[model samples]
Target: MKILVVGGYGVGKTTLVGAISEIEPLTTEADVTEASTDQDRTAGTEAKATTTVALDFGRITLLRHGLQLLLFGAPGQPRFWFMWDDLATGALGAVVMADTRRLADCFPIVEYCERLRLPFVVAVNEFDGSFPYLAEEVRDALALTERVPIRTCDAREPASVQAVLITLAEHALALHRAQRPLTH
Candidate 1:
């Protein structure tokens, strides 16, 4: 299975990928070239040091199902929107991360997943000890329908990151089952 992990700058998309990756991960990160600073201004994720010049890729195996999963992390910068199409191609699903403080940065990703008809889950990456935001409130804020699964997690936690992957996997399975004829 192939998955695309996407979110706003400094939202811990890379960290999430690293936390759950079983094998050596491949990431395309470049020094924060001063010229591109203008494109990296998102309030909640200002701590991001290296900008993903291309994309982040990783692979893992789920022991439970013996499923090999490939993950592609898309660069968050709007200027890199061109890369989104390619990263999304052939992905089984995607996890769109969002920072409560700068939620708008995630809309483009959500829209892209919608356009591609890819099953996706929205994960809220918490910062510090901040209180949890209501999932329904987030749903209303993002104007998302009830069909989209919304989850809250700390991108820094391996378990949390894995949970997001599990959610997407389950969603993908359901979608696949729904597409086929009943095999009674």
Candidate 2:
């Protein structure tokens, strides 16, 4: 199985992938330099020193179910969006991570998935000191349709990340079933 962990800049895409990956996650993070300060948006992630320039790759093997998930984290910066289509190729679905502080940042990714007809679940990455918002409220705020699942989690926790992935998998399966033609 292939999945893309996508979100806006500094929304914890790499952290989420690393938290649950069974192997050493492959990350292409580059130091944020002053040269591109004007190009990169660093509003919500002021403390972030590095950015994923290409992608983050990781794998999780579910031995019992005989499933191995290849997780890919897309680069969040707008300038790197050229890499998104290539990364999204052959992906089964996506987890759209969002931070309430900068909710608008998630619009592009949501639209990207929708335009591609890709199934996705929205995961609100709960950051400390951030205001508490219900899943329903977030759904409404994002103007998401009823079919898209919305859930909250601390992306840094392995268990929490696993739950998000589980939700995503279930949602994807449901979508697949719904789209499948009924046979005799």
Candidate 3:
């Protein structure tokens, strides 16, 4: 199954993909150049030196579920948003990474998934020194419906990333089953 990891700039989409991927993840990251200083907002992520220019690719096999997930991390900046449609073409679902400090940054990604009718789960990336907001607070802030699953995660941790992925997979599966036509 193909799953997309998407969010705003510096939201840790690349890190999440790399953390859980069994193989060496392929990243199209480039150093943050001076020219983009005006285009890229670095308020909460001033230390972030690189940005994903295109996408990040990774893969993980879930032995228990007999599934192989092809992970695609979408570029977060608005300039590269044109690539999102292509990345989402065959994706079964998505994990929308969120930074509580810049919660608004993820709004577009969540809207995109909803507009595409793509099942998704919100994974709040818990950065150091960031406020500890409960999952319910995030849901309320995002104006998300109860059906949308939300969880706090550290993108750098494999177990946490795995849990987020599992939530997305289960949510997608449930939606698929619900939409299937009943048969004799």
Candidate 4:
């Protein structure tokens, strides 16, 4: 199943895709502005020069059932929202990464996934060691469900990134099962 990694500009969508992608990812990199850097990167990612303009694509093989996942990173801009629906088709689920600096950036993506009734989990990418706020507070602010897993990820580690995919798969399987019609 394909999974869409979506978030706002500089929100680590590309990094997330790159981290989990078993194959080298295909990404659209473009120059970023100083204004947007604060919202996207703080310290660890300060060296950032280019940002994804379109999407990032790659694949990963799951340990369970040898299931394979195609990861797609959404462009962080609203204009690219047009491609979001298409990218999401047939997706098992999504990991919508968020930044504490700009929590609002994640709202649209989260709402879109919900509207589509797609299973999704939120990951707060730590640009630096410090979190401006607590995870519970952020979850409250987003009004996310208790069952929707929220966790932290570095976006540079393959093992850590794979955990996100595994989590989504669990949620997706549950979602589909719940939607199955009851037998008479």
Model number with the top lDDT: 3
Better of 3 and 4 by lDDT: 3
Off by over 4 Å in 1: 129-131
- Answer with 1 or 4, whichever has the higher lDDT: 1
- After superposing candidate 4, which stretches have Cα over 4 Å from the reference? 33-47
Candidate with better lDDT, 1 vs 3: 3
Ranking by lDDT: 3, 2, 1, 4
Per residue, candidate 4 scores C-alpha lDDT tens digits across 1-184 of: 8888987777788888887787888987878777656555334446668877678999888677797889989887775689888898988888998888788878888899999988999888877755666778878989998878887777888877888777888888888888899898
Whichever of 2 and 4 has more lDDT, that candidate is 2
Tell how far residue 54 is off in model 2, in angstroms.
Answer: 0.1
Q: Estimate each model's TM-score.
A: 0.92, 0.97, 0.97, 0.86
Over the stretch 1-184, how does candidate 3's per-residue lDDT look in tens digits?
9998999899899999999999999999999988776797767787889999999999999799888999999999999999999999989999999999999988888899999999999999999999999999999999999999998999999999999998998999999999999999
Model 1: per-residue Cα lDDT over 34-63, one tens digit each? 677765675554565677868888888978
List candidate 3 segments past 4 Å from native: 64-66
Alpha-carbon local distance difference test for all models: 0.85, 0.92, 0.93, 0.81
Model 4 TM-score, 2 decimals: 0.86
Q: Count steric clashes of candidate 1.
A: 0
Colliding residue pairs in candidate 4: none
